[model samples]
Target: MDGCALLPVNSPGHLPSHHEVTRFHCHSDSEDEYVIIELEDLENLSVAPDKRSSFEPGSNSAEATAQELCRAFRKYWLQTDSAVQLSDCLSSSKQRSVRKEEIPRELESSLNLAEEIKIISKLRGSSGWSPPRSQIIFNIHPSVKRDAVVAAQNFTCVGCGTPIESKYIRRLRYCDYLGKYFCDCCHSYAQSSIPARILSKWDFKKYYVCNFSKHLLDSIWQHPIFNVSCINKTLYTKSKEMDRVREAQEQLFHLKKLLKTCRFAESVLKEFEQVPSHLTEELHLFSLDDLVKIKRGQLLPLLKDILKSSTSHVDGCELCQAKGFICEFCQSADLLFPYQTAKCKRCPECKTCFHKACFKYGGCPKCLRISARRTLSETPSLVPQ
Candidate 1:
C-alpha cells in the first residue's frame, strides 16, 4: 500500500511490509461490508517472523490454530463458514488470523483465550490508527495571490538578494508596483522603513501605495557611496544636500541658543582660539576686514575657525598612515587639502596628516568640547591610554 495512504495519527492495520504485525482494528465500515482498518505500532508484537515462517510445511497444529481463530472471527464478524479455503487470505482478515495464530505459542500457558482477546483489544485501541477523510479541506485564501508580494520584490529579495525557494515563492505576498517579491526579512524592512514615511505624511488608508512607493524608492536609491565603478554620483549629491540641510538646521538651532547666552558664544570663540597655529594662519586671512566691526568679523572667523578646527582635530585615517601618506587618507580623499604646497596638519599620536575631506571623515584625532566634556565627566579613567 502507498505510504501516503497511511496517515500520521491513524494508519491501516494492513502491515506495510513483511515485518511483524501487532494489533488491528476496523476503523470505518462501507456499504460493501469491507471495513477500512489500521494496524497498531509493530514494536509491541511478540511474534517472530523467522519462527512463524520456519514452521514445517505439514504443521497442522499451527494451521489448525489459525483456522480456529478464523472460526471465532467468522462467528463474531464475517458470519461465514470456518472450513472454507483461505481464498481471501490477502485481505485484512489474514491479520486477525495472524494475531490468533500467535497467541498459544507466544502467551504464557496461564493466560486464557479471554485474556488474549482482551490484550488484542487493548493493543488495537492503543495503536494509533484512523480512516482517511473522503474529503480534505484547506482554508487558504483562494484569490490571495500568495507569491504576489515576493514577485513584487523580485525573485531575489530587494533588501538582501536571497534567492527565494518555490514553497516560499508561492506563499509570498506581492506588491504590484514595487515589482519585487519580498521575503519575510525584506517585507519587514519594507513595512517598518517604508511605512514610517507614509505614517508621517498620511494615515493608514493609503499605506499600501505609500509603502510600495517607499520600497521602490529605496530599491532605486540604495547604492554604495564610493565604488571604483558605479560611484552613484547622483545619490552622493543628494546625500550631501541632505547633510547640508541637517547641518544648517542644527547650526540655526545652536545659534539660536547661543544668541541667548553670551557665555556660550564666548565658549565657541574660545574653542576657535584653541585651533592649532597652522590652521589658524590659513583661516586668519578672512579676519583682515576689521571694517566689519571687531565683533562681527570676530564672530564670522570664529564660526569658520570652529568648523575648520573641529574637522581638522577630529579626522584621521589608519589606511593613509599605513600607505605612508602624511597629508591625505584615500577613502576620504575629498578631505585632502586643496593647498598641497601648504603646511601639513598631522595628528600628534598617529603622526598622520589629513586634508579637509580626510579630516571630516577621520572622526576625531582630538576630542571636541561637547564630547570631551561629556566623556571626562561620565567615565572614570585609569589614567591615560
Candidate 2:
C-alpha cells in the first residue's frame, strides 16, 4: 500500500450517470399534483432561444405572448399530471410483484450451504444503485450503536437485504464502520481502520468492515483527502508526536519546491516522485493511511530518507546548488536555502532567506523596501487628504 501511486493531479469531474433514471415527479405543496418527468421530456418542452416559437405565434406583443405561453404551460402540466396517474397505477402493482419474485437467493447460497431458497427479499423494491458515484468521501459516519439498532433490523444482511433468521444469523458478521450485519461473503472478516474512529478518537484499531467499506477506504489510501489543520486542529494540539510529523511534512513540502525546477536534480526528483504529493506539495492534506503510519512512527523515518536523498543531490549538483540563497541581512559568504531549517529561516512577509541569528535583528530587507515605496507613493495622497 505504501507503493500506491498518488491519484491523478487533475481529479475526474462528475460524469452524468448512464445507468438509471427514476421517474422525476415534482409535487406542488399547494396544488397537490405530480407527473412523471424524464430528462428527455424537459428537452421536448423547451423551445430554442433563437426560435420565434418560444413565444405565442398569434400575439405580436412580447408581454402578451409570454402571458399566453405561461397559461398554456400550466394547462399542459395539469393534463399530463392527471393522465399519467391513472395509467401508472395498474402497472406499478404488477411491477412490485415481479420484483419480489425476482429476488435472487443466490446471495445466501453463495455464502454458505443453506439449501438455496428465495425466502428473504428486501421489504422495499430496489433494482440497483441509481445515483452517480461520488469521487471523494470527506466524512465517515460513526458506527451505529448495534446493541440498540441491530435488534430492530431482525437479523438481516445489510449488503443484499438477505434475511438471516435462526441459525442463519450465526453466518453474519458485524461491520464496524456501518454497524450492520452482513453475510460472510460481504463482510468476510476484512479489517480496516475506521476513518471515523481514527479522526474522532485517534484509535488505530482495525475492525471488521464490509467489502464495500473496505474497498472504499483502500481506494483513497494515497489521495490527500484529509486536511488536518481544518478538519481537526486539536489533533496537533493534543498529540505532540503528530505535531512533530506535521512539522517534518511542512519542511519536506517547502524543500520540494526548490528541487521541482532544478534540472540537475532530476535523478532525485524521479525517485522521490514515488512519495505521495501531499507529503511533498500540500502541507495540510493527509490520507487516512498517512495518519495510521504517523501513529505507528513510520512516516517520519520515511520522510527523513526523502530529505536525505534530495539534499545529497542538491549539495553535489552545481546546477541545483547554485539555486541556494545567500544571507542578505549579514551578507554572509555561506549559501542558505529554505530546507536548511537549522541555519536559515525565511521571513514570513517577503520569504527572503537570512541566517537564523541575523533575521531577528535586520527583519526582512525586501519587506522594508516595499514598505518605503508604499509610504512614498502615499505621501501625496496623505498631504491632500
Top candidate, metric TM-score: 2
Clashes of 2: 0
**How much lDDT does candidate 1 score?**
0.32
Shift in Å, residue 209, candidate 1: 14
Off by over 4 Å in 2: 1-147, 151-157, 162-172, 183-185, 200-202, 234-244, 292-298, 316-318, 355-363, 377-385
What tens-digit string does per-residue lDDT give for candidate 2 at 169-215? 55567877655576665566889887656765688889888765565
What lDDT, from 0 to 1, does candidate 2 have?
0.53
Error of 1 at 200 (Å): 21
TM-score of each: 0.17, 0.54
Worst 10 residues of 2 by lDDT: 29-38
